[model samples]
Target: MPVAYNDDMDKRLIQLGAAVIDTEAHAIAALRTRINGNFAAACKYMLACEGRIVILGMGKSGHIGGKIAATLASTGTPAFFVHPGEASHGDLGMITEKDVVLALSNSGETEEICTILPLIKRLGVPLIALTGQPRSTLGKVADIHIDISVEKEACPLGLAPTASSTATLAMGDALAIALLESRGFTAEDFARSHPGGRLGRRLLLRISDIMHKGEEIPAIPENVLLSSALLEMTRKGLGMTAVVNAQNHAVGIFTDGDLRRALDQGIDVHITPIAKIMTANCKTLGPDLLAAEALQIMQRHRINALLVVDTEQRLIGALNMHDLLRAGVL
Candidate 1:
């Protein structure tokens, strides 16, 4: 059974939720000042690292460290997370002289991480630390220390890792993005790392991959009648047909929109040449163009279809908005 609603209690809960967001927001906002020379040095170390960046943390900081590692890996930086506890039991071998170690601890003295500091130092790898306490064991030992302290936690009890964790994650993102820019990483580079994701499809899929080709393309000769063009459009079901010249060059395009305008003008579909109703010099795309870019062209011109042409402007394929939708490029 549902309990009766308490209006005053509900109001108080809503206000508490808003206050928590405000607290976390302020914590992240304060991190802007922490992006200093030390931040630059940390990025430098990671950028120069030949092996994967090994991240270590305990409890909540460990969760944040995992996310930070993932962000770095996807942004053209090689990185992975190793639990501090696991490092004690032979996992410490994973950290090599070519790698850089990044440790996260709000108190700057997580026992699990401290246990491996000597091993990491012995490996002679660069160590960067994210901690609220600059004078703590982890911070004092690190070659580079980044302060991620916050004024207060969003937790009312001041015990949970709320604001501090948020600050650490933001700093991690700052490091990843700074290195990404430093490496001159482009969208194509990012797509290579994320071939299974939506962004990869948008970047890697070309018009040739999805456009209707050969017999699938609805194209008619410029001298064909409007009635024949309509039949071709129906057979192809692409809602459009390209009007080609004697050399199979796309001279114009006839789409559903053109059919509407021709009807509004009371033109004879059976007797009128397709050229009379076709849009001359219609927008055409190269087969090598990206499908995502094709969508942009369609949107900017307010058209639903496009003809694919070769370097000589000869019609090679055709595609419509539906093709993009079906291909997941929309």
Candidate 2:
């Protein structure tokens, strides 16, 4: 009977996983030495492309190609992935003469991909090949060839594509980032591409877009009693209220946190003027400012809310950091 040991096997499995990571790191490091004029030529071809980039590969290479296509598409290069096997079916109709085809193959002899080479040539689409064997058929026929060869696979059997796939993926990332930099892709541009992500919220959200305006803004006259201001704070649900002068300009702000401090000091809520207990140095934001900028001001000042003011110091809106969180700008 096999005995079950008390020691956990999880640590050994973690170390095995680390080995694959270490192997891929070394493989990418070695690729630095192989960067020659070919890499530059590949970038130049992509930069000069008038249409979208169509990526093609087979097996594990196909999986990496799909991710590369996504990265390229998000980074300002219009790109899409086409499985070589599917291209041999009806997918070949998606390609056009203006597009550039980026093909990936470890041995540079994937039959499915090679079968479509003649058709691609007939369409006059330029080909960029990524392969381990430069002398293989795919490389010889390609308009531009990029060498992505690796010394060995991280897999113990030396058959599974481990380091090679990692290297290919890294090359694809390098290409996308290089194009992004060359095209001056800004954070705002990136936000446009990822409207559902946190980065988009940070870059694209504006104060006017998330602030409480008109009656939603809590405000009380400077002569109002503290008890009345507290009711305004409670009704507005912002935990605070602005004290405005007869001219409707914000003079100070009072919050629930302030009320607690006032009570601790034995102040009378009914007789005390709201302006007397209000914060005179309250921070404010502009309606046109980015929501991310508003968050920074609130965090730096250790405050939870801010009043929106115009150039004339008139309060137009009010918002708390919670508003930013609710708007997905946090």
Best by lDDT: 1
Q: Against the correct fold, how does model 1 do in TM-score?
A: 0.93
Ten-residue segment with the worst summed lDDT in candidate 2?
2-11
lDDT of 2 by residue, 86-171 (tens): 89899999998779999999899999999999999899888999999999999999998988998889998999999999999988
Local distance difference test, each candidate? 0.94, 0.91
Q: Can you write out model 1's per-residue Cα lDDT over 189-240, one digit (the tens) per residue?
A: 9999988888999999999999999999998999989999999999999999
User: How many backbone clashes can be found in candidate 2?
Assistant: 0
Model 1: per-residue Cα lDDT at residue 162:
96
**Candidate 2 wrong stretches, greater than 4 Å:** 1-15
